[model samples]
Target: MSLPSTFDPSRALSLARETLDIEAQAVAAMALRLDQRFVAALELVLKSRGRVVVMGMGKSGHIGRKIAATLASTGTPAMFVHPAEASHGDLGMITADDVVLGISNSGESEELTAILPLIKRMGVPLLAITGRGDSTLGRHADVVLDASVEKEACPHNLAPTASTTAQLAMGDALAVALLDARGFKADDFARSHPGGSLGRKLLTHVSDVMRSGDAVPRVPREAGLMDLMREISAKGLGMSAIVDADNRVLGIFTDGDLRRLIERTGSSADLRALSARDVMHPNPRTVRAEALAVEAAGLMEASRITSVLVVDELGRLSGALNSNDLMRAKVI
Candidate 1:
């Protein structure tokens, strides 16, 4: 692990690339090994009445934690149980209806094997992820997924490199298979990851966060610029919607227009002599109430505007939204 006085860029890059290629090849091979056993494991987890209890030791344990999380977040009930802890009463987490998934490259982790007999006695189904189907863990499993790899990505072939990668890919395949089987949708995913960016993007609709009702600034088209300015100031949107007699949106008057008009006419009082229709920009960029808030952010950024109107299906103003709304919703 000594640092060289001078680094050789090409040699360093080639070593990294070789390691990646080896692991990639390992994952590619594991895909070919998928068979009926994989399907059986998927069904076993899907049909279980209780949660999926994931168990593993060492490197397999790290992979198990992620697998459990993926399963739980993707509409399946699952959790990771450390095999060592299970031996010391953590087995209480395992219910009779739960399905136990044990992972080990050799399929013979002593901590896991020790509890296999008791789990079987409890009548809970056992699923195994292992490199060797004939290993003790695999033999005892109700269903076995072959997660074998040709060789380790380690240069000396002593590390758990390629094998762990295959295990991860296998776990992903299981999660996705069960996810599709359950017909999980984006809303369901958002419920699990409510605090993440993906959740905000999927679950936060324009109507949910928009400033609606009387809070939206609106004035008749015949209203004077002074009236519009007052509405904008009262509503704090920095803009006012000019609606026709039918309450349909006619145009929008923003602070940008006020700034430009003041610069052109050289006086603030002179600009107020005009009507709303005289100074408003017609056909402002708008979004529907049902659209996602992130879409509103996109519209604002792409058009180089700070605010936009929320309109109904028939072009009636339903609400107002601005860059600030997006920022508050964490959609920015």
Candidate 2:
């Protein structure tokens, strides 16, 4: 479409801002609508023996799908079902043990209304989220959630704008309430979102990514500068663990230590008299082998360093990791 002849940039921005403000106010008003019925709905879903089956039509259907997904990911078992499909045998998916969450802006979606009787017959609890409490769907529902909005963000007040925003907020409110009641934690969320980056950070342990056994660069505490330098260079870890006879880490000699050593000595000959202990940093940061990879990244970032040693229960070096390893694991 070509630009309108009367188009004005200032007017366009003002209209967009007005739409956002209207939607924001609509969502804010929903907080005040939380009543005894809201708690009743929460308790119904909380005590439900089976999954939450969400249903709706049109834009409300889209919002319903999102609500079901959020609830499922946050520890509540939920699935979205099309109201139109429910009349065509999909209604069989609902059991008496399940809870049905129906969404409709006017509380009069015909597709949804078609199956309301069947859902009621199944003895399933129905939670209606609508703008009208006396609406057919609301009156027949076991519990009603008021999602009415004063007005829509639409200039003509025809589109589902503020009403949909209000519904979405209420859906989020329900999911969060269930989340807290279930005592759902980050680890549980990560499990549900296993394909995402957050799952990698939360579930990937340091031991899974760290280089262990011979892969770790180690030199005896009595080892010379040449041996330490060889170990560091061969491992390409920018550092080498200087350990004692018992394989207990005594110190770490890093590239930074090499720089300081060179600056102090001013010649290669000065390095000949130095052993690993003389130039090694005695206080090195360590992480437990079972720690989350993200936690290791946190330590590395906070210390402004690129790597950390992974220690066993005995405080002996078991593995090693650097920023490169974390990057390879996609944990950073």
Candidate 3:
């Protein structure tokens, strides 16, 4: 067709949507075709003590990186090794206990094939994810997971679109299966991703972010309001726990309470005359020092408070955390 003088925006969008629909169907087709070979591949990876070395070339290499990341974050230790790099001595990273996952749309990437013999010689298990089950790479692999697609999303039917999507999804399936088999929990995932918000929610304990001991803003029940404000200012937690002689939390005096008290009594003389017990909000929210930081965040949000007292098993004050702590730790 000749080019139109003006562009047809709807036609261009329809073409893009058609491509996505084709790829989506290709992935859906894979679910029904998953067989025993997929199980065997997962078993090989899970049983290996060393990491999974994922390798590919061209577009396959991009997908390989994502697969490796997914595997590493989901209890399976994995890293991407380019086939070209492998031929240049990077192959030493692979160990006998590791599994080699080679991805190829045509099942015949020459760079990948060039290093397969050496990987095989090292006694490392070889797994192939490819569009062709009868290709040389598939035939040589110990286990093959077919990632075939009927057509490419490319208008010319040449680009690696649907094929790579299938491969990526298959890799995810393998990683999740290994994760379940290994009984990998959220805490385990948090350990690997400690720098992110998910890690803060799962791995950060109350003790990790809470203010401890004397560092906690606290005042005795009989202490004057000025003394309580001094403690709050020094600790900078926006609230002070009012404890008794035994150091057990009796009530909490917060900035909000202070504001309300000031509104009612027009003088600093009246505020100074008030004792901790006289101005405090009794039975303030508290959390155990061992609780998850995420739990603390929920308690704060539910009570519409900015801070909570961290207590021990016996209900004695151990530490304190406010909205600031949650923000700093990325738990919120």
Model 1 TM-score, all chains together = 0.89
lDDT tens digits, residue span 1-332, model 2: 99999999999999899999999988888898789999999999999989999999999999999999999999999999999988888998998999999999888999999888888888899999999989989988999999999999999999999999988999999999999999999999999998999899889999889999998999998889998899999999999998888788888888998988888878655687789988888968999988999999999999999989988777688999999999999998
The ten-residue window of minimal lDDT in model 2 covers 264-273
Q: Which candidate number maximizes TM-score?
A: 2
Better of 2 and 3 by lDDT: 2
Q: Which whole-number lDDT from 0 to 100 does residue 246 have in model 3?
A: 83
The C-alpha RMSD in Å for every predicted model, in order, reads 2.8, 1.3, 3.5
Ten-residue stretch with the least lDDT total in model 3? 265-274
Query: Across residues 1-332, which tens digit of lDDT does each residue of candidate 3 receive?
Result: 98887778898899899999999999999888999999899888878999999999999999999999999999888999999989898999999999999999898899999898898899999999999978878887999998999999889999899999999999989988999999999889999988988887999988899889778998899999899999999988888999988889999998888888878876555567779999998988999988998999999999898989998877789999988988888888
Global CA lDDT of candidate 2, please? Answer: 0.92
User: How many steric clashes does model 1 contain?
Assistant: 0
Per-model lDDT: 0.91, 0.92, 0.91
For model 2, which pairs clash?
Answer: none
> Which regions in candidate 2 have their CA more than 4 angstroms from the true location?
none
